[model samples]
Target chain A: MHAPADPAPLPGDRRHPGWIAWALLAPMVFWLAAFVVVPAAILLVYSFCERDEVGGVVFRFTLENYQRVFDPVYLRIFARSIGYAALTTAICVVVGYPVAYTIARASEVWRHRLLLLVMVPFWTSFLIRTYAWITILKQEGLLNGFLQAMHAGGGPFNLLYTPAAVVIGLVYAYLPFMILPIYGSAEKLDNSLIEAAYDLGAGPVRAFSAVIVPLTMPGIAAGTLLVFVPAIGMFAITDLMGGAKVPMIGNVIQNQFLQARNWPFGAALGVVFMLMFVVTYGLLQRRGARLAG
Target chain B: MIEIRGVTKRFGSFTAVDNLSLSVRAGEFLTLLGPSGCGKTTLLRLLAGFEMPDEGVILLDGQDVSHLPPYRRSVNQVFQSYALFPHLSVRDNVGFGLRMQNVPAPEAAARVAEALEMVSLREQADRLPHQLSGGQRQRVALARAIVCRPKVLLLDEPLSALDAKLRHNMQLELKHLQRRLGLTFVFVTHDQEEALTMSDRIAIIHRGRIEQLGAAGEIYHRPRTPFAADFIGQANLLQVAVVGRNGTTARVRVGGGLELTVASAELPAGARTALVSIRPEKICISKQRLDTENLFEATIEEEIFQGATDQLRLVTTQGTRLHALVANESAMQEAFHEGDRVYCGLHLDDLVIVQAE
Candidate 1:
């Protein structure tokens, strides 16, 4: 209603055609269409098709691939993946909230120092960090070595190639991602609002719950998305730390691509994974917008 | 009653508050008035237990509550920015303190309702703080503080953020609310007008020390220090000569060699320098000379129209400047233009001789 009155554009300025702008941006548009949109189309098409003995996708319509996704084995793996991601999101929240709050509330010199500490671990390659954990948790690795040096150690521990190690690696890798977002949220939080909470009779615990948590909810949502979504399709951490002993859906789909030579099933999994992301993210966004409102 | 004794706060080398001692009487509305960076807010924070005094003790009802946290202290502050909780509905914000003390749901709700009604914000209970107007939010903040019924209510310039019209209205509203509740209010502000209107007693702070503390009327009509006279109200601080001294009253000479009778217990004579405090409102403006004892001729140097009143800045023939306030719109309508000659006189009780030899 209060928009400043802008002058009319000159007739000469109309020479910049809309289609020329689109043509200038064609590369990025086509790249998304090919890499993201086209692959999604292929997955959508393949989800309804049958597969041949040689693993080529036969373009005959069928509901069998989606039905296979709901089978007991795949269903169990899907449930397990959700449970792991949910637990990872919850733990990241419980652990990261305080770290972010501390960093945000620290002195200016220490605030940057703490935020830098949270980010510095990312200087090395992410895969290398996960692999480094594999070396540490191996049968005769540093943990067992330290345990043995204490003199009352038992035989070599079978910690390697377990779900626990995968969970540990996932948490360690995603903790920084979680912290940065929560920290951004906490940093923007008004100090006066917190002081007001104290004046209102909120003891430390109630203040954090009713005021601090709700105020920083956007950061929690961002951190949850940053940690949970990546945790779903994680392969390297599970393959190295979980020792390929148990078949997670990530490894299952990886096997179809490399070992089993089944392009159709991999395409089917790709389509389902992308759909899960779309649905989960859509629900998350709507919920976030509602809370923000 | 609230007492602050020898309290000091320092952050590294910057001493925000120096050793300061003051007390607020029960059911009294006292303001800590000073300019910005004068430690009024710091003193308020020390009383609220937000910041601990590095040197001395704070007592509430003769009990040392210095080391206690803000939550443990029986005091509430209406923050300068009207720091209402953005996330909660107004009802929840007002009920926050009650909920913390484990007050039952029904009782806490009743108190919240009463407090909201006290601030005339009962209809805004469902709205969030951001949804309300600035004045409404300020009231919600006030309601939140008084809902707890703390022994002491500290207001840190709660109306400073408001627009001029709203601030003026809220001042009267807050004064009425404070008197009705009979709760001790420790108000802080840099605005002298706000201090004069709402305060039962005004403690004028300067450089972390109290320059003067007395009844509003006493502080305004008879300020003892030059700083207090200048800071608390726009006073004309001019040099005067001590012509002679009786038992209590001293005869002083202003520019143009005009003598004015000023109250002084006793003072030495043969002195050329003396401090005189005269409020702009007390000086009478005349187009012709009057039968007044202290009168001088001056030309208008500046004429400022402030709606109902006009402020006239005059310079005497002896080159001493004085400010005069004319209350009538007709006085302003027919007022002398800049450079017009006029006779001005000062009332005997209106002048306070701050320092005399």
Candidate 2:
């Protein structure tokens, strides 16, 4: 008796959006403007200012702090920080990938339990956890005592207060972050694609490099950035574990603000760090987009 | 050429593929057609060396390939999702297999170009897979699979993701490509229409067994099992009584006292049980109500106009229902009106008698 009803439930074609979309997006715009955009603007302004006698930032215009950031003392420190972060990131990828892949391909019941295990360590405060590491790795700490109980010849290996200890701590802290995103990407990887690669005359190594690695690149990129960027600016680990022996860029910047009493120099360093983030993020985004396209 | 001998795959306790045996002649176009969960895809993977059968042997060109790893086999598969490298342009994706084989650079480029031309995608070689439409991506996948020219090509529902019109075009294009290249194809799909339209031979699978394997016409017209008859086409399966038999032919008494003969190898000697099947189009409908030897009176319960043809569901005088399909039904008017009296005839040769149980 009546004509058939229209099947399409959505009102407008996606090509043309309506006012409701803009309304829904308002809150996101407000959040980004309040936190991210405003902070970046303040940092930019502080970068161009001069420091007063008491380390309070003065509004007087000056490019002196920016010029001083290029000094050899600071540049060498910056390079060392980058080198350490890069090494930590590389280690995390090599160590985290197999664990993540195993967890992803596991049975359903075990997968949830395994994911919980990965997340459990994060419930405790990160600083407290770092302190716990100091207790374990320090001289006459659990590791050294245990080594001595085993009748080890060397009195105690100076395992703590070294660059290696800093890396170990960083790798331990950020490993789960590296694992989770790569796990997501690897879990969604279609199994047939791997079979196709193998069917087309690719050896196991070739299939992994050509198909699996490329397919899961987004996760690898995400994990790399997650570990590397944070490791670069981690002043706490350097102070606690590196025994304040190594002067990383992060330590230098922190000293400028609180110890050295040079707020403008610290502001300049913060701005440079933020700019480095932008460059690294832009390059990674382009690479991911190229792969997806 | 590929041969699967008594291959069986079991997942824990449940069997995915029963002990199945079939062969693919060189340059033959074969399809494994079935419903979902019917194990056709499992069989394809076995042939591709992705899964090792629990008990069986696979031979390619008279050599035992059962123990060979997937990479060592001279075969390639076009995955249902296309599996185009998201990181690579179309040219690189298509050229991947050739590169793996260590072919010379110029030869690989030439072969990739030839393969791309075959799919009419040479112009889009520089574009990524996502940059192309779904149909174009499908052709790109086909080009990638064919570039290696392996001994066998396995396709797992390759065109199923495309829209209706594009699917039709791709079906024809795939058949043409298969013939031109003379490559053995082992396609898997649940679409019976696609199987009938494109395949030189169809292995109708059900559950974990191959119910029947023959040419398309043979499988459609001379269905060996009730499942095959119901799956391949619309059949008016009416309960009937086998009144008599003579050599290869048998006379069956259907509902409403209609009698028909069918050529079948086996039929129990009894008038109590049998199912006589006839294609909907095999029934002749008339409005004038003439008396014929093979006649049945009915009333039209529903009539549906299907553009080119009208389908009528009728109830007989004895309250038994039957469906009839009329081609170009616009001009053939009258008794197709709802509740109008009609008489129909069933072609004797078209009648197929299957076991009732």
Candidate 3:
């Protein structure tokens, strides 16, 4: 038998001379240094420093900011933020999978049209869309007005400025992120594999659970990360939809930076939040690779 | 036993299978042999219940299953691409059908092991489909389908994906396995040689219809239609003018006004235009004139050196071309070269009259 050949190198693998690669990557390197590396370095320095009485960061080295981030009040906010993000991710998956599968299995023309519908929301500004949701969900908004006009029992129930409204806003904003990746996986799934399952006497449910689910796990994983990571740090939606009534980790971090005027404490919270994302993403990536293998 | 009666399947404007009817005997290996788009694969899919026939009934052992879903059918298929579940181990794939049937764990394991052993793949039972070679994956697919032990097994050109030599080996292995299992097989293929070597009976399909169906020997030796004659094997289908009919034979005038007699039970009554099929190997080429009534002098146009035989392209004096194959057993006996003048002899029993259409 012939030995298995080595896998071909990925496109990102550097095959050119060192100088040429550095030249090609110069612009991206400069951008990352200016935007990402520089900001991260500044945040790291601020996290370990002291804040002056007037809210300007002092040069004296200190660890009190990191200690203050783990206090009960801030920890509770972090937990609530995770709870909301986790719930949003779960609902997105439950709602997005069937829509993605339907679009993937549609004929070529319809598939394009449905995908366009999914993406059309992204063309407008996100903040404008959130304001639009505010218009619809507020008391005496279109939905409550229509219900009252139809003589429904409940009149002007508190719909906006609630946790449910926050979730609705998050789901609306991140649904396409959940769908597009799953659509990609579902579209490439071989129809013959499903037929083979049926031929082997598997019922529709069993075939889907056993064969289809494992194959599309990569897409689900990617969608989960995309929906979960950004939703955790989203402060604008809670302020607009939840009316800033309840504080999430994002609101606390934002208040420290702007309202409370404590840049060091805010930088500490940001560093911890960034570390949590790295750990979660690393674990998810390992699990995804295992599923694919 | 499987019966497909007057089944018709249409895709939009194209009729994939048109009023086709066929019966497969129990425990026999029957092949649907045809070129691509001739509805052979579509017919196999109909039997497998992957496609429902638009117009007829498919009976499995006397029960009509025309509208039954594939999971409810008693037929299994080995797809051309193998279609093995990539996430499952070979053992799991082979046991999937049994698991669906709710077989006991111990029994399913034993049966899966036996099936893997039958395919000589027990050692690789733990490997995933991606880890296996192409031939091994094909064997896993075979084992997976057969482990279910359905009444009829449909193979849709399963060997077409392999290389030539591997396909040859798998053909013999599959034929042997079918005999040992004593299960009915409805195999579909476009390879004529594979059909001839592996099938107990061959059905030649053309344009969504069966032109001929018989044993391999009968199909090769006495093809009833010009399509079957030209498709199954290499044949020189000469257009002949019928001179007269005598009993079951007819005398026809062929190339360069050369008169020949052929079997004519298939010819239409009072037909003047006829076609006769003659295998190249049946024609004899000699330097000296043979003492036969069916002999004509021709000049060799080209000599093609096949591995086991020499093919000579001969043209009669009146410019009618004929091909003759001489076995290369002896150098002296097969010494015909290009441009050499020779006499070509034809036997009465070697010619078959076929329909032009």
Winner by DockQ:
3
- Interface root-mean-square deviation (Å) of every model: 8.7, 9.5, 4.0
Give the lDDT of residue B223 in candidate 1: 89
Binned by DockQ into CAPRI classes (incorrect, acceptable, medium, high), candidate 1 is acceptable
Give the candidate number with the greatest TM-score.
3
Question: TM-scores of the models, in the given order?
Answer: 0.91, 0.90, 0.95
Return the top candidate by lDDT: 3
Per-residue lDDT of candidate 2, residues A1-293 (tens digit): 01121232333455655789888999998999999899878778888998888878889899999999999989999999999999999999999999898888898899999999999998999889999999899887899999999999986888899989999988998899899999999999887778778888899999999999988999999998898898889898889888889978889989998898888788899899888887998999999987776
Candidate 3 residue-wise lDDT, A91-165, digit = tens = 999999999999999999999999999999989999999999998998969989889999999678898999999
lDDT by residue (A46-91, candidate 1, tens digit) is 7788878877878899877777777899878877877877787888
Query: Per-residue alpha-carbon lDDT of model 2 for B165-214, expressed as tens digits?
Result: 77988898899889988899999999999999899999999888999999
| DockQ scores of the candidates | 0.35, 0.38, 0.50
**Chain B TM-score against the true chain B, candidate 1:** 0.93
lDDT of 1 by residue, B103-153 (tens): 999999999998887777787788777677777888888888998888999
Q: Tell me the TM-score for chain B of model 3.
A: 0.96
**Real contacts retained, model 2:** 0.61
Off by over 4 Å in 3: A1-22, B264-268, B291-293
Candidate 1 docking DockQ = 0.35
